[model samples]
Target: MFRPLELFIGLRYTRAKRRNHFISFISLVSMAGIALGVMALIVVISVMNGFDNELRTRILGMVSHATIAGVGESVRDWPEVIKKAEANPRVLGAAPYTEREAMLQGQRVAGALVRGILPEQEPKVSEVGKKMVAGELHDLVAGGFGIVLGKELAYKLGVDVGEKIVVYAPEIRATPVGAVPRLKSFTVVGIFEIGMEEFDSGLAIVHLADAQRLYQTDGPDGVRLKLDDMFKALGVARELAGDLGGLYRVRDWMQGHQNFFRAIAMEKRVMFMILSLIVAVAAFNLVSTLVMLVTDKQADIAILRTLGATPGSIMGVFMVQGVFVGVIGILIGVVSGVIMALNLEAVVKWIEHTFGVAFLSPDVYYISDLPSDMHWSDVGLIALLGFVFSLLATIYPAWRAARTEPAAALRYE
Candidate 1:
């Protein structure tokens, strides 16, 4: 159907002067629409990808890849568990931690999740030590009962470094007066900000020994593990659990935060579907353009049929013309989208500086910078979608052109 003769005529018709300027204008509009739609899809999808990556990195910086905990109140043999976890080649580091919910009182009172860590071993599985802004993690001595607070939590409690706060543990003790909550006074030695509300606004850290004494625990509650490949955390956790012989409960980071990540993924998919409508609308415009062109070129089609051109060849000519328009638009959109996505951050900064407007304010948003992460697979899929839509739009008009009768078409002429 797409022989040299048909190809030549199809290419010629695309460039030929049209008697009806409306038909030419409609064709141009269809091409522009496709280009704009494709560009928008690429940019939007890239931005979403960037946000997902950034959030994951920030959250994982505080959360370990996997954890192993005893079924009881505390893991009494935490050191042995760490040694066993270290034997796995995939496990890069391991650390034991104790966690509890507590209320802290300074000038103001607020609830927080209190965690205890060994200053030396904590760095093995998490980045809290490096994230400290005011003091060092090593400042918490065993007997000193020093504490580190999240930046937001510290602000809410109206305290800073060198100040003191009283922590009320959930555990209660019997006294002559009545049952009272176990409580202690801890000196605020440091502050850290993780840029996440979940941690920054409700987390506190203390020395492991101090935590054990205060909480009346035999040892750390669990051992945290860091894997070489975080994405393989589930498999690694499962293998570790199996090796431990059901004596302990093992969980991966995703299990703790699956709902949050799932929401982000669902939003991305919804945005993709919503943006695809723009491309679909643009591709459907091809139907109108080709239909008009077929009506305007009735004489030409009739002449071609009379000259022994097969109906299939006639259909091929119109299909080729429509595809050419789609291809050009897709190519332009792909090139423009790639260039824009690669420099999105710089472009956003420039706009903000020049316009004196902040798209994302640091006070309002944890991540104030515009980020873009383009995936080639997304680009390829969008291009294919455009091409398929364009091709489908050509069928009806091309079929109508192929069926034109020579005698009837030339009767008016």
Candidate 2:
């Protein structure tokens, strides 16, 4: 197959050494700009995606995806509710829980939500036991008024496992004193760190019996559920509520952390839009480069037109050239992004070590280190957008090249 002479010349012109040093430098700058923009977008977006994923695992893993509860009071015979909920294929595990808000006093008084959990079943529903940094899970079930505190809470109160902590909740005394804050003491049995400041600072866990007794309730407040896909929690909760004939109310994870997750999603979308402009600016460089090339090759354009080249073919040649520029830059960017994303933790560590700085601090940030999650879809999108921009950049220059006057060029020569 013979290729068009105009196309051959177009490619040749792209490769030819220009007499103007400024033109060559501008062309190189355009290519470099595209590469840097693409690479930065990929790396930043991947890190954002990584943080989103880490939040899901670190936060959702410790809490129930959904909860099945009665209309008013604590749930009695939660075993039956668990059985009914588990009957659905979506349910992974369910466990009864009793919880209350009270002040924990041990030289210092701080507000705390003491969750009552069954040692054997808690692990099935939450990552609480798995995240235990100190002490043992089984020790809490030994009926010694054992309790588990979060790392931050332990630090704040200056207490650890085996230390005694008093919990105060409103108690109902019918005799002389009316309803008053009930006071109960528990021995700290475990300390856990889930990398969540909110939980680590204000959450504690104890035996279900202890919690119910502490709350003066005969049964658990509700049943917490883990699902195969936690993101499906809201939909499943709605379905379960309907199945229960409205006798039971359902609450999902979205309700618990609505503001936080919503903010994150909104930020991601905004960042995508903002970062895409880097690609747009870089693409504009292509427009300038193509226009300059067209101006320098005016005689060649006239010759191609005299040789019977159609305007569409003229456009195709330059468009292909612009696309080539974008393709090379995008390929380099994507490869670099993947390499950096995969090793982001190490890279951050190395930078911090060299600069004597910290990227994330447990007290300041929820996590203690940098995280990165490379997404191929994001890479595909970046390359696609770059191609589109390149094509757009070729338009004005291509139109000018296609409209060159063949007769006028030969007359001037």
Candidate 3:
């Protein structure tokens, strides 16, 4: 409905000087508000994405993508299970492991989940071999009864490499006097730091044979598998379960830590909703600005109506002006937001260095550095929403302007 005449007049009105300077001030404020809201949304979302990615990487580095375990206490044919798992093209690596909760006594006593792994094959499924700080995975020998401790667990037990610690298994041994917990002494052979407190504070590693011997199990508890793509863990696990039949159980990495990731996703959605309100308020400001502009231009509107301009054309004039303002604000916001998100990490580091203050101290937080990962899709979504809000704000005021009576408007003028 908008002709070149409406377009020319709308552009002229937007650029033309007005007697009411307050209208200009309100328009500027609206633009600034939209820009600020969009920028904040982009930066916050990017940081959240970065944290999600960082945590996922660290956690997955220590855990397998999927696992297949026996229906009973141990998988007697674990090597066969590994072989079958490796036969799948999606499965990249597999290793057998046994796990049990035990108490370690040294200078002090601490509880931990002790895991048994084949040192030769461990590197294929997990990164513990690469994360050791004090010793190597090879130090955990089957007959020697050597153990690897997490850095925090070692500190809690007041033990180090070469020190001996007593391990008490949950299984009981019958004695002449009474039944007692099965116990063994294992020399600390290695220390590893995964950076996550859950692992670093409560995990111990030993040879698969040693764990089986200590727990009195005939074989390893399960087989862990690493896939070519971590995201496909669930599908691969399901296929393995079907192939292995009802005799085994299969689980994916996501099943073990669903709550943590779900909470993060919920928080992100809430943040987006809260931030969108800011842009909505700014866009609504356009309503008041257009109403005032329509009143100010009544005489001009009357002249155009008397000259036979249609009401639809009159409405289009104001709509074009409002849309132009919205587009400008969104463009400014998108450009500024993208730039800030890309440099947020560097900016945070600079501030910390200059002020001698740590926002995330290494002593207190596992992830000490500020991280930002910008996604262009988020920027585009924000811009689109801002424009839609701005466009909706112009409707009522434009309709009011279109309904003006030429005779009354001219008489007033």
Model 1 alpha-carbon drift over 4 Å, by segment: none
The residue-by-residue lDDT of candidate 3 on 163-231, one tens digit each, is 999999988899999999999999999999988998999999999999999999999999999999999
- Highest lDDT among the candidates is held by which one? 1
Poorest 10 consecutive residues by lDDT, candidate 2: 170-179
Full-model lDDT for every candidate: 0.93, 0.83, 0.92
Taking all chains together, each candidate's TM-score versus the true structure is 0.96, 0.95, 0.95
Q: Candidate 2 versus the native: TM-score?
A: 0.95
**lDDT (Cα, 0-100) at 369 in candidate 2:** 76
lDDT per residue, candidate 1, 6-99, as tens digits?
7789899999998899988988999998999899999999999999998988898889999999897799888889999999999999999999
